[model samples]
Target: MITARREAWTGRVLLVLLMAITILPFLSLFVTALHPSGTYPPGLSWPGEPQWGNFLKAFQAARMGELLKSSTLIVLGVVPIALVIATMAGFAIGHLRTAGRNVVFIAFVLGLTLPFEGIITPLYYQVRDMGLLNTRWAIILPLIGLFMPFSVFWMRAHFVNMPAELSESARIDGANTWQLFWRVHVPLAMPAISSLAILLFLWTWNQFLLAIVLVDDPLKRTMSGALGAFQGQWGTDIPLLCAGSLLILAPTLVIFVIFQRRFVTALLQGSLKG
Candidate 1:
């Protein structure tokens, strides 16, 4: 009992330290953002008097309004359809005994190993050739495909563990495949679906590399992608830049805080089911 207690205490201390490490940069950024515009603080230090205007200045200068709209539109275009495709695919592979299931699952598993950076050159050329360059579709279309591997895997982990008896009973009621999926399985999959939605929203909203490489117009890019240009323009204005970054990070922080439980639940479910 004493040894176990010591181990538990050690784990608790490690967790606390890890949490602090994670939070430190954001704390530094928040503190730095409070400094006057154009001034760089030597380290993490609070200003004598806060320069609250820096946030407003950063917001307007960064064109956050436009970036926010573009990010929202891209996320909308990506998440729902991706979810639909991923969920259907997951259901087919996990619950249903479809032909070539192992081969298809292996294909998706291999897709997990593909690096996003490796495809950028070819992806850009393909997008340009297709006349999608500088458009949101350039980002949106590719992200849906890119996200599928992990998305389908996560959903499959859930559906695979569902009792086959559920499908058997549903079929006895004269339910077809479509009805079994739509009426029975989908409602029960809401926890997994909701958590996946939260994750995809965060990913699609914050996607920077694809957004930057594919789209040129800063206004059309994701808020994070636009930050590259914003930083280039305002790099000297450290406080303003930090403030703008914090602003860009706020929505995601709010979302994660709100849905953190669901996210944690998803992790737990995956572990238990797997």
Candidate 2:
């Protein structure tokens, strides 16, 4: 009885500690956002007034609608193309017995180690030569290229863990390479696909360096890019900055809430597959 009681107490204490660690920062941000514009002493009662309208002000000043549109376009372009390329590359590497499959896979893995800074200058000149710089495609294409190696590595692990008999059975059923992958393997890999899509969406949406380096126009900037601009414009307004950050965080939070299970499970499964 004593051990059980102690264990329960310990669990409760840990839970409370964890909750405080997670929630306190958000609570402080909320309080700061609610703080009145005027001066105040060291510490006292909550602000008598809350600038709840700061959210709308953030949206207007950041031009959040255009930011959101650019973010959506970049994510939409990157995720689907990255997934398709990743799936095909993973399938080939995992299943095919080609002469240089391992070498090719290693080459792809090497891409993961290449720093963005190393390639940015060359990429800038290439984008300029192609006349893609300052356009959404500049950001989208670079992000897809940057993120593809990781996706391929992830999907390859998932495909390798899947039973060989699955693809064999598909082949026995008169399914060709495309059909085997799309109808048989791809459907089974939906969890990994979903996990990758969610991650890719989050990364692309939060992309700032690409937007800053690739795009000079305000209308072409994403939420993160717009936030950078907003910070420059409202350099002294901390509440507005916090409100803008929270607003930018909303979509990814909503996505995680909606697909938390698949996102977590697929991430684990992809990494842990035999």
Candidate 3:
């Protein structure tokens, strides 16, 4: 009992430490943002008078409204389509065991190793040739494809772990492939699907590199993409820049907070399924 209590206390301490590590930087950013735009307040020092309006100034200066719309559109464009493709691909590779499924799965596994940066040059030329270089489609199309390796891997993990008996029973009931996938397996896969949705939402939202590189118009780029240009313009203005950064991050933080439970559940579910 004493040893168990000691271990529990140690675990609590570790968790607390990790939470602090995760939270402190954001807290620091929040504090820094409240300072006057041009000033560099000392380490963790509170400003004499907080510049609360800096957020508004940052918002307008960064064209956040437009960025938000672009981000929303891009996210909406990417997430659903990616989820469907990933889910179907995962179901095939992990559960259905269709002909050439192993080969396809192997290709996806190989995609996991292909970093975006490495292929950005080729991708840029390809997008240019297609006349998509300066457009949101450049970012959206690539992300859906780029995200597939991991997304499919995650969904496949969930589906493969589903009991074989369930599929067998559904098949015995004369369910077609579509009905089997839609009715029996999909409901069971909700936790994993919801989790993947949350993940794809986050990734697509904060997709900075591709957005910045592909879309020349900052307003048409994602919030994070705009941040790069925002930084370039106001790099010298520490507080204003921090304020813009925080504003850009607000949606992501809100989404995570709301869906945190689902995300954690999916992670735990995946681990147990494995």
**Most accurate candidate by TM-score:** 1
Candidate 2 CA-lDDT value = 0.83
Better of 2 and 3 by TM-score: 3
Error in Å for residue 150 of model 3: 0.5
Write the residue-wise lDDT of candidate 2 on 1-274 in tens digits.
Answer: 9999999999999999999999777766666666543333233335677788878888888888888888888888889999899989998897755689899889889999998888989999999999998999999988889997898898888887888788788888899988988888888999988898888888888888878888998678778877778888875787777777888878988998999999889877766776
Clashing pairs for predicted structure model 2, backbone only: none
Q: Of the candidates shown, which would achieve the greatest lDDT relative to the real structure?
A: 1
TM-score of each: 0.98, 0.89, 0.96
RMSD vs true structure, all candidates: 0.9, 2.8, 1.2
Order the candidates by TM-score, highest first. 1, 3, 2
Which stretches of candidate 2 lie above 4 Å from their native place?
A: 1-19, 37-45
| Clashing residue pairs for model 1 | none
Off by over 4 Å in 3: none
Per-residue C-alpha lDDT of model 1 across residues 1-274, encoded as one tens digit per residue: 9999999999999999999999999999999999988898879888999999999999999989898999999999999999999999999999999999989999999999999999999999999999999999999999999999999998898899999999999999999999999999999998899999999999998899998899989999999999999999999999999999999999999999999998898788778877
Q: Which residue segments of model 1 deviate by more than 4 Å?
A: none
1 versus 3: better TM-score goes to: 1
